[model samples]
Target chain A: MLRRKQFWFAIMAILPTFAIFGWVRLFPIIETLRLSMHEWNLLSKNKPFVGFQNFIELFSDNQFMDALTNTAVIAFGAMAVTIPMSMVLAAIIYHRTRSRFSGFYETAVFIPHVVSLVPAAMAWKWIFDAKLGPLNAIIMGLGGDALPWLFDPVLSVICIIFLVSWQTLGYGVLIYLVGFRNLPKSVFEAAQLDGANGFQSFLYMSVPLLKPITLYVSVVTLISGFNVYAQAYVLASDTQGAPGRQVRVLVLDMLENSFQNFRVGYAAAEAVILLSIVLLLTMIQFGLLRGKGGR
Target chain B: MSAKARARRTNFLLDVTLFVICILLLTPLILLIANGFKTPQEMLVWPPTLFPKDPTLENFHKVFTETPLLQWMLNSFLFALLSTVAIVATSALAGYIVGKFPFRAINIIFILFLATAIIPFEVYMIPLYFQVKALGLLNSVGGLLVGYLVMSFGIFLIRQNVIASIPDELLEAARIDGAGELWIFWYVVLPLLRGPLAALAVLAFFQAWTAFAWPIIVMTRKKSFTIEVGLANFQSAYTVDLSLLSAASAAVMVPSVLAFVLLRRNFVEGIAASGMKE
Candidate 1:
């Protein structure tokens, strides 16, 4: 390799990468931002500039609000439970379990991590099925009523969260388990020497030590949770289905408006907002975590 | 002596209980695997049985015969194969650049790419679909590959692994030794990165292979349909063949499962190696 040519070679190595990123990631995002300003539907004769009206229309839409609220409830509601439990389970496997059972347990739990959203949703939907599902069977087995799972909007959302949590718990365990392993053994040992036994050792030493893992889990889970579409789509049918697509998440709505309805400009505006939220939340998450010696 | 014996027995019992919990975690799939061989009628027939009596091969045959499951499987392999290749190559290059040769914009780009991990594919599908359509990339397998690669968490993940594992001194020594950048990357860095890169490859393959949302939005027809997308189409009033659908699902799932198990060690090591972003 020529010495001066080496620099070009280094640059050349990354050129294909930049080309792909620019075309697929960069261009779409920029195009979406630009498309938000123009009303160009597939059926329309003359394309015209719409300025900020798409944004205005999106915020005012009732369906948009419903989707937003549903999305938040699922994301936050699921994470609130999962993060704490993951910490506790991770702690048990890390601190309490001395034998190789932890490895067995970790792998078993993480198997669901490898399973995708679509099949898992189908299975969970079966579990939550009203007529023939096992959930109802178990409920009835316990002398309870068989309830409408998907039909009831609230129950459906909760069930979806359950599915999300199940699908994600393995990842949470894997990541947190690693974090637990990385924790300073001396800190816990010192706490033990201080007679901080059992619960105290966990409370005083383990929890604080796993703060980094907790923060990481929160941001990652939040991101994954926000992007949840496959479960909703798989369970609810392609775009939006009968019973008014009650479980329609924001992404679904964005899909319907932009692609199905040919509201490209409006959909582009929604995309921009959605991306902005994801980006902003990510920054905020980093900021919040980074505050107390954030990683 | 009696008290000590009791304590030992209790400890043994507790270990068994822990094993039971592990079994419960895997029970769903164990149930599915047992039932994947059953007729739809037999599967529905419940005293809620665990094992199918006949354990027929009919469902598997229905899977292959009625559905384009084999085709979808081929597409899935292609999708996973091509995307993994792209991610490993691009990410290794990009990671090498940002890892060595510190630039002023590196930190900002690092954060930008990291932030991309947050903006899920759903957010991009509509815009991306139109982008594909406008660029004349509709119903194209290669186009899907590009869309998948753009979400470069694999790069960011690999870079983190590279940074954590490889020392800057190695690069410095190589530079002094007149080993060029390409040579350094190919021989030194890539070898060290094998662990994380393999792990990320498994992950990247899974994500692309199981991808449903973008495939739904971008690929308008069956020609470019991936396994997951095609498997989903059965339930969409397109077909009511539940048995065939499940068969297709198992087909999509088996390769991923195998990849996961085969690469299991690396996956754990990779995630463990990176620690966490928090």
Candidate 2:
């Protein structure tokens, strides 16, 4: 009787969490998948099964094509910048672990990660402002032509990539620092005793050992990079006179389709694609983790 | 002169280089606060100044008076506070059972919680929005709080902490002494979990506080906007007054940054703990 009562207690205790998670997190993905296959503008009661018709239409959609290409570029681009840069920064901080300034350094790098995203992106926007911004001011002062950072087609995407990297860099560094701290110290000691310099040891030992960390950080960064909406929106959304060419990204595209154009079914299809990409990336992460453990 | 001296010299150089890089990294944030104090005329001046020529609180006053900045802040605070408390409670309750209970089905429950972390929010936000709408929760605090009330990461973190820290014998002892399970959890398990719970609370609060994408979609009205959404909207409304926009951004950033700096250890440890688990 006591055992049965304990079991029931556990079930009752966990049921609320299970309910909330299922309703909010799990149910939505299933519903989104289901919604992607039907045509409804979020208003009409008459819904028709489109059966991959929306996906077919999205393949030839020019705006989605641009959004896809830009999003892929930005995702890969941000990952490219963040991974190596943060690893190196973490290596430096790890080596200086005994320094009194280590805490200060970590906090300084991490402040950006915690700051509200819109404000941080706005700060970047002001810096990258075409005519009146400080970036142009510096360039012109240094005898280089003032490039339109946000206005130009290619430059604008690069601007978004930079913003993504700037925000994610702090997080990447923090994770890598943790990775460094967890690394076995004897390998470094062995390398040093064999007369390896700091750079050599870091290049060979730290790099290979932290391969899992690098993969984890890159996947996380790329996932967030794929979800890049607010940075791109705040940077280049349509303004009155001097609007930069709006960088069509995946999330922004979905929002426009769903909310603005009332193409709920079509946006749901786009979301399904985004979901597939994220799910694939997550699978890779899990596969690697399991593989590492099995070995 | 000596090997140790040479190594010390190299270390010194590295520290200086790292310091310079840190400053470079912090410059944009510094500019965010610095530019907020500039007068409008100074803001529009050719070859814009980094620091304000004549700093004033005029722009901050304008942000408060001209916009619904207080309402936005209040909304963000309530959203963060309420969601953080709910997530902590639910995660702790679930994590305690999943971590400590030896039921045959416990593994499945734990795995189900872990699985939710894999799906990104954007993929399902459409359906979530629809669900909220179906429940008639659109443009309300309940709508905003609905999606954030249960965090998969929080559940995982608390479970990990419980398993690693709280030995089952203590709970068993309490049980043998005729204490109810919930009573033991409240008195014994919770005190042991104070560290991770604090860490989870800090993380959850930050996530709720700085949340932009979902909140922006849910709260469309100007009066219900979170600080992030409000700050984004400030750009269009105060386009001509750059100082006012900067002031708004700075104000929104202050609380999170201050909390982070004050609780720096818990914040960093919480993040590190999450990353390390993955």
Candidate 3:
């Protein structure tokens, strides 16, 4: 009798939430799935669902291929650099410092992780601007010729990478710091008494021990790299992959189709494809982390 | 040197090096603030000044006068505040529901929520836009508010906090007290969930405030524009006004920074929590 009543109450609470979830998130996902089969603009009144044509077109689109390649390279690059750097930062911050300044340094570094993306991108844009930009200024000051940051095909991607990560190192450092803080200090002390030196103590004890957090950080970093947008939009003003379509990433493709082109069906197809890639890669990363980490 | 003295000296060196690196990390923000006060002409010099040489409020005045900054700030605050409130309220109750219930389906549902966070908002951008449009919510504040609420990350973030803090014994005991699940949640669970609730709320508020992409699609009108869109006005096909842009840039960041600093502990903890968890 009591069980039934409690379940009823729980259902009551979850009901409005369910409607909200259905109406807002879940319905749109289903709608997108349906719309991906059609080839109609949102502005059109009479729409015919041409099943799988949009996806087929996306498969053939060379621009889609370019966006995929750029996204892959950038996401993979971020993971490769940030993962090891974060581990090193965590190991060093744990074993290296004992001063009151560590706290101040941590706080200072963490501020960027919280700064709004608009200013962050704008600041990076100024720093990297080709003419009259500080980047050129620094290069010229060093008695070297200036290389274009946002204009060149190669350096533009680098600029995207740099802008996204200006403070993400702080993100990695801070989180790994917490996971480090939560470690039982006695483990390191135990390692020390066993004739373990500095690098050995970190490698033999700390690195092996911080497995859960390391996996967490890598997963987050990979996902965050995929979420890179505000920089490209704000700095480049959706003009990335400029100087010959070199930097148009997946999100940029989606935004261009949906916003600029207003081809809602075609855009939905790109989005669905992106969601699959992200989901698959994320799972693979986690599965590999589990397999190697001895978790 | 003595062994203790050598350790102290080494630690001091590391701190100095770390401080230098920290300064490098913050170089962008320092540049923004530094250039914000410069006259537009001074800003275009060969090498940017470390400090504004001819400090002027002209750009700041231009930013304040020409841009819809004050309104944008208010809109961002309200949007963020509502998001925080909705997240705290919904996630607290929902987290309790998942925590207290022993149903096998709950974990799957929780996992479903968590898994959604991994999917980028880019995936949902197109369809969700027209969804809002169908509800007749384009160019409206209510549209932005609801759009922010359906966020996977906020619920996912709050759920992690809830799952971490709520113990099984506490929930079971409330059940044994002839208290309803809602009763236990209202009186017992919410108080304990305050730390992470506060954490998620602060983060959600910032996320809502710094929201650039969603506002672009939703708020199409000039009067309805948020701080981010207003800041984007500095650039166009013809000219890039660097100084006024910096001032406008400063305007966009200040509210968010102030909000984070006011809730600094929770902000850091929330970020740490998110990174540590998933």
Which candidate number has the best DockQ? Answer: 2
Docking class of 1: acceptable
- The per-prediction tally of clashing pairs is 1, 0, 2
Q: Choose 1 or 3, whichever is better by TM-score.
A: 3
- What's the best-to-worst order under lDDT? 2, 3, 1
TM-score of each: 0.90, 0.97, 0.92
Native interface contacts retained, candidate 3: 0.61
Task: State the lDDT of candidate 1 residue by residue for B63-100, as single tens digits.
Answer: 78866778767887888888888787888888876666
lDDT of 3: 0.74
Candidate 3 residue pairs in clash (backbone atoms < 3 Å): A241-A246, A241-A247
Q: Which TM-score values does chain B get in all models?
A: 0.87, 0.96, 0.89
Error of 2 at B191 (Å): 0.6
Regions of candidate 1 where Cα sits further than 4 Å from its true position: A1-6, A43-47, A96-98, A237-246, B1-17, B44-48, B103-117, B161-178, B237-244, B272-275
Error (Å) of candidate 1 at residue B35 is 3.3
lDDT of 2 by residue, A65-164 (tens): 9999999999999999999999999999988999999988898888888887888887888899877799999999999999888878799899989988
Which 10-residue window of candidate 3 chain A scores lowest in summed lDDT? Answer: A237-246
Provide the fnat value for model 1, as a fraction from 0 to 1. 0.43
Residue-level lDDT of model 2, residues B1-278, one tens digit each, is: 89999989988998998899889888888898888899888888879899998999998998898899999999999999999999999989998888887797766888888876878888889889989988998889899999899988888888889999988788778889999988988999999999888989999999998887899899999899998888877767656677788888888888778889999988887899878775
Best model number under lDDT = 2
